[model samples]
Target chain A: MIAAVLLSLWIGSSTSSIAELRHALFSPDERVSDIAIREIRWPRTVTALAAGAALGMAGTLIQGHTRNPIAEPGLLGINQGAALAIVSVAVFSGPLQPWPQALLALGGALAASLIVFGIGRVDGRGASPITLVLVGAAVTALCAGVVSAIVLLSEAALETLRFWQVGSVVQGYDSFLALWPLLLAGTGLAMANARGLNALTLGEDSARALGITAPRARGIGLAAIVMLSGLAVTLAGPIAFLGLLVPHVARRIFGADYRWVIPGSAVCGALLLVVADVLGRMLARPGELPVGVVVAMLGAPFFIYVARRRKPVTV
Target chain B: MSARRTAPTALLLFLATLAVLCLHLSIGGTPIPLPDVVGSLLGISPDPRTELAIMEFRLPRSLAALCAGVGFGVAGALTQTVARNPLASPDILGVTNGAALGAVALLALTSQVQGLPMFLHAYGLPIAATLGGLLVSALVFSLVWHSSLESNRLVLVGLGMSGLCAALTSWMLTLGDVYNAQQALTWMAGTVNGVSWADLAIAPLVIAIGVALAAALRNQREVLALDSDTSRALGMDLGRDRIIMLGLATALAVAATVIAGPLAFVALASGHASRLIARSTVPPVAHSALVGAIFVLLADLAAARLFSVVLPAGVATAVIGAPYLIYLVIRQTRVRSA
Candidate 1:
């Protein structure tokens, strides 16, 4: 997957320098090749990898914590919250700034998480997965409604946000650069808690008996989800299916152990996203398809198959 | 089950709906005094502009709300009954998204076809939207029909279809230039803006079809409320009945979507609400319709007049409905726990 994505990146970048490709690859000067590799291909490749990994990790965390198979960020209202916040910024503000949009998206995501958490926590023992999903669906629908209203009311913002809303990876390198700190922090936390997450799968009572504070573990898991999801949204809009798809694929390959599942999902997610980004770049020639759209087109069928095959899991 | 308790609750609901209608008519940007509005309704007022404004703008808007609401309500109730799941609705079934995609696509493709007669456009949009919705419903039905129609599987398929439709819609928006994209985006979000006399005409006809079909399916749906095997054991043609009920529900959903553009959660939430009020395991269709109409009418009124900057009624419903849904889930959890 990595090689494929790299090859696609090379092809995309070389479009502007088609005449010099053979010389650039084996030249003594090496300046042209260096510039092409560093300036054009590297940022796009890295961002795609990072964004995909973040979403994959986030999806795994949500599925693990909630114990629900279908709980992607998009399905759970996190994406909608982040998208709404970002759109609000793009529409209301003249130019797009990464930090503020990131902060606002983080805020919206956290707010939505809290609401879902609260709803799930109703039994004094957290929400059932089904209830949580329903609540998320409700919140997602509501947020979509509000976002639509805002877009309607503000034409300029709507124009700017349309592409972003479609989930692109081409917001330039700055947005990717801006997301690095959050990505590092989130990934680091999630990796650190892999054992705890695995313990969580044994059921709350059993995990508690095994010396994990179920609530604290859940809280940590929630934090990890927020960070990863926030960073992913900041980098590449709300690409759906990555988080849901990557982790499920990882689980199918690596079994249900969080120790393996978490890292496996991360790698799988990065690869999936990079390949998707590469495909998006190549599919329409010069005018790129957004990675989000590519993933959806690819992911939707897989998701349906997963849904049909699996028995419903509790959150 | 006391008569005294049932009578008062029904009475209260009726009065509340009436009060909401009055509020809808009386309140707007140019607020006519409540008495003048009431007097105009009674044909006693001589103030022609206020009357015209109230009769023309407010009345149709309120009526549209009522019709859409009831349509949504019946659709929701039918979905819940058929699926035996509280979360099931036309929106979840991909009907609304499908309809909206159809309508928006038509509008986007026909940029040159603007300024046509209002009647032509009105008929055109709903027809296109209904076709889109029915198409999706057909796809979903076909995909899930091989298996026993489990509610969970049906919802899962619906969710998948909705995601696909949403992606397609987003892609369409992205492909369009800024102006057309903006228009499509807003329309997808849903608005009662630009509603006209012709639009009103489509509502009544579709709604009539929905209601008549719903009435016809009343007994069959009740049987369907029982488990599939039980319904079948009772000599009902489970497969055929499921198809008919689903078809009718889809029609209601398509109609509501055409009129209101997937007004968020009205169908699902209102059906749930009616079930709660009816205190029955199965949602009564008539009660659901009444509840849906009340919910939509009130929501529309609130959207139009509540805030200084008028939001679309869809936005208002979602804002209010989403949190309430959370509360309901929490409440259900608590009940289950106890």
Candidate 2:
């Protein structure tokens, strides 16, 4: 992870000398490279780390709670919900301050997930993986339809949406600073929920026998996922496939233990995003490709590979 | 249910598609009388101005919607039959995304490059989109074909490929002029608003061939719906039949996409809608095609007339389709749980 962060900080459209970077790092110099490094590169690198880690942890929680290997925060309609809310608010009442934007996003994400869960559930039992995913797809389509309608209706909304539609780490540090607490809270919640997730994985009845209280555990886990994903979307827009693939990578590396998987996903997710961001910067040259684009391209083949290897009916 | 039971449903759907097509033709900017519209469609000129409006403007748009709908329906029926999964469609299987990426890349490229030839500018997109859809379908089929194509694996592989294609298309959006981006957005939303006779030159012929191919595969489709082992036990060549069906479906999807820019849910919903109405085991190809045509025509009508600002037909279809999808899922859940 450190190596990945260093690589992101060092590489760009233009590279700075090592001595200059070192001098800038220590003395807060006023050179162009220093300013770029401090203002643009540093925040972007940190934002990437924070958002990636949050999404990775969120993905782990979602997959664990849903017991669906294919589940991701994005697949749960959280990203679309947050996007719809942000776009609607922006169109109706101008751009908001970062705090309100984040709050609205969190509200949107929570509402969307709740809707998916509510509609997906049959009887009192939680939805099957296929049902959850299908419902998620429907909700996502619905949100996207409305969003496109609003975007088409207003030029101001269209301009705002064009940038927000693609996930990028090219956000101001202020936004990151404003939302970092929620990330920390979400991470802490995820860590706390890990053991319960492990217990619940055995089965709800077995988890109940173990005194794990499946509903409470799922509730906490769901909250963490929504918080992490919502805030991550706020900081970096919606990064596709990052949340979906991170937990699988973590499980492959750290085994099925939730305690290990949670932290492993965070580190791996951070490393992957930073590397993808660096690659995006390098590949596109003068204008960088969005990190979301790069990650989706990179993650898709892995997704296909996973799908091929897994059994058809179950994880 | 057999053909006898479904024939009436098919006939009704056919009449409905024609009625919707007429309504689509007559209700645009200037409302032409039904007699005049019918006359224009039958090669009789009501007058020069009305004839121009009907023959030149509305006819092409209506034909684009009809042909595109037929293509999507045939493709959807073939795919769903082969996959044996109710949810499978060319849209879900990455063909739409691939085609959209291809078309958008061409438009963005042409917009950036100065003094491109008019021929390439005008005709490049459909060919590019068709090639793109075919290439991605080939990639998807190749990836999933380990001896025989498995149903869930095919859908999952397609989903992954579509994700990649969608990402590339979005990145392409940032390439050139913002005006070009808006144009790409409108097209990607699946509008038939600006389709002209020239834009649709290849659509009718390709769609006809697609329908023929689908008809040829009707027997195989029924057998393919059974378990692969069962079908193979009954002397059906699972691998060969799946390849043919998927290939035919991909071609039809490409044809439709080139005309209407991936109309969102026609392919996904048409098969199910037809089966629901016809009470058939498999979505009958002819009935599904008629249902698909009516779906797009009605969607286009709503898109053109119901909105304060004209939106793409794809938007209306999605709005209609998503809820229907949710309802389907819920019903499936109920049946399974019950």
DockQ: which candidate is best? 2
lDDT per residue as tens, model 1, B72-148: 88888888888787767887778888888787666655554557667655467777788889999888877877773
Q: Any residue pairs clashing in model 1, and if so which? A: A91-A157, A120-A126, A120-A127, A129-A315
Compute the interface RMSD for candidate 2.
2.4
lDDT of 2 by residue, A1-315 (tens): 777877787887798787767776888778898887887789888988988898899988888887777778877788788888888988977766668777887898999989998998864567776788778878988888888888877777776666565435454356788878888899999999998998998998999999999889988998899999998888787676898899988888999889999999999888888898899888776777888889898888877776677463222
Kindly list the per-residue Cα lDDT of model 1 for residues A176-224, writing each as its tens digit.
7776878888888898778788777888788888888988887788899
Candidates' C-alpha lDDT = 0.75, 0.82
For model 2 chain B, where is the 10-residue window of minimal lDDT?
B178-187
Q: Candidate 1 regions off by >4 Å?
A: A2-4, A7-42, A83-97, A124-127, A145-172, A195-220, A254-260, A278-290, A310-315, B1-19, B34-47, B108-124, B141-150, B176-186, B331-338
Stretches > 4 Å off in candidate 2: A123-125, A166-172, A311-315, B105-124, B146-150, B175-179, B226-230
For each candidate in turn, the TM-score is 0.83, 0.92
- Residue A307 of model 2 has an lDDT of 68
Q: After TM-score superposition, what is the CA distance of residue A100 in candidate 1 from its true location, in Å?
A: 4.4
